[model samples]
Target: MVAVGYTLMCEQAGPKQLVDYAVRAEDAGFGLAVVSDHYYPWLESQGHSPYAWSLLGAVAQATSRIDLMTMVTCPTRRYHPAVVAQKAATMGLLSDGRFTLGLGSGENLNEHVVGAWPHVQERHEMLEEALQIIRPLLDGETLTYSGDHFEVPEAYLWDRPERPVPIALAASGPSSVDLAGEYADALINTEPDPHVIDLFDSAGGAGKPRYGQVAICYGPDEEQCRKIAHEQFRWFGLGWKVNADLPGPESFDSASSFVREEDVADSIPCGPDLEAHVAAFKRFVDAGFTHVAVVQVGDETQPRFLDWARDEFLPRLRQL
Candidate 1:
């Protein structure tokens, strides 16, 4: 059976509210939960970006059953890999082995705040090095390493779970997918494309859990849903290449100025159609994703969406 999960969008929700949402998601029957780690909201109108690690710590205490993970944290620049290993290790213990560390090469919007922006290839190289440093530390090993991209001098995680936290690497292309196959316990992708699954499996990710995220809006009014999705998430239409390069909200706003309601509607399922929501997720299942995270687009509609998910959506999805 495919594992259904809920997305706790930290960029769109406050810390306490996000913690509460995790509890609600567990009650709603979601087996896993993923949260975005962002320094700033994609669009200022969306209006929030709390510290993801701190919020996750609270979530670990608040929820008992649901699995938690970072949809993707960039351990390359804004924070060092050693720091990420430490934090993730603590989280694993706090959640009693329920935490997974999802990592990516990162984007300028979040990693640029520290005032250095490397080229795309350089970032990927940095990510590989970061993973090398993180993996051993999570296994409770002390390590010293000097790499072209990173340096560590006798670093070790003082507190760790009995087992190493699972690492899920985010991939949007073949190169990253291959990296994930070689290094990660799982693979995470935003799109529901079978080609991605094919590439991952061919590159040695066969039998590993493939994770995906689907964005949608749930409400009674279609027009309102379209408007909300367009306002809050149109930045997503820019594609990863552009999304990774853009430095801030202003750049995203300028880039998405031409985005219309139709564009948003086409990308994210909207309104009260139960089949639309199920179909949106089915795309991932069809693509061979073993785990999927559904992100409800608007903050105001979260409670209603969760209620509907528990009562309507999840039950039907499980049968699929």
Candidate 2:
């Protein structure tokens, strides 16, 4: 059976509320909790962006049984891979070996703050080098290196869990799929694309964990859910290349201004219909995802959704 999880969207709520939600998710019986590492919200109306690592420390202390991870963090720019390795190692210790580090090539929205965003190919190269540095360090080896994209001067993590934190890579295409298979311990993708999984499996990820995320807005009425999803998640309908290039919430808002409610609702499983939500998750599971994270788009219906998930959603998904 696929391990179901909840998303603690740092871009949607403040740290305190997220910590509270993390506890609630654990209480509601979610086995895993994934948090996004973002410096800005996709849309200004989405509102918050707290430092994900600091909030993660609090979440680790607040919950005991739930597995914790960054849905994805970009180590190529704002954070050096060495620093990310340290943070992941520390998080693994804090979570008592329950933390997985999810990484990616990253979007310009967050990375541009440190420097000019590199082109896609350079970004991939940087990520590849980052993985080389991070993977060994997490395994308790001191690393000192000179690479085209990064330089590490003999860094090591003193505080680490007994087991190495699993490194999960976010991949959406052939290149990234191969990178994940070559270097990462697991796979994460937002879409239910089986081709991505097939590539990863053949490229060395055969027995690894595969994670998928489903975006939805659950509410009392379908109309409300559609409105909420459009307001908060319309930017997601923008293709990855477009999503990765935008510099900030304003840029996203402008680019997504033309996105219709129907467009957003078409892709995301909105409303209170349990079957719609189940089918959305089923797509990923059928595509071979071993872990699925449900991203509840808006905050207004969190309590209701959590209640529904505990009583209705989870039991049905487990039956699959």
TM-score of each model, in listed order = 0.98, 0.99
Instruction: Put down candidate 1 lDDT per residue, 1-320, tens digits, no spaces.
Output: 89999998977888888888899999999999998999989998888999999989988999899999999899998999999999999999999999999999988999899978899999989999999999999988999999998899889888999989999999979899989988899999999999989998988999999999999999999889999999899998899999999999999999999999898899899998999999999999998999999999988889999999999999999999
List model 2 lDDT by residue over 1-320, tens digit each.
Answer: 99999999988899999999999999988999999999999999999999999999999999999999898899999999999999999999999988999998889999999989999999999999999999999999988899998999899889998899999999988899999999999999999999999999999999999999998888779998999999999999898999999999999999999999999999998887999999999999999999999999887678788889999999999999
The 10-residue segment of model 1 with minimum total lDDT is 10-19
* Per-model CA lDDT versus the true structure: 0.93, 0.93
Error of 1 at 223 (Å): 1.2
Model 2: residues >4 Å from true position, as ranges? none
Runs off by more than 4 Å, candidate 1: none
Candidate 2 C-alpha RMSD relative to the actual structure: 0.8
Return the number of clashes found in candidate 1: 0
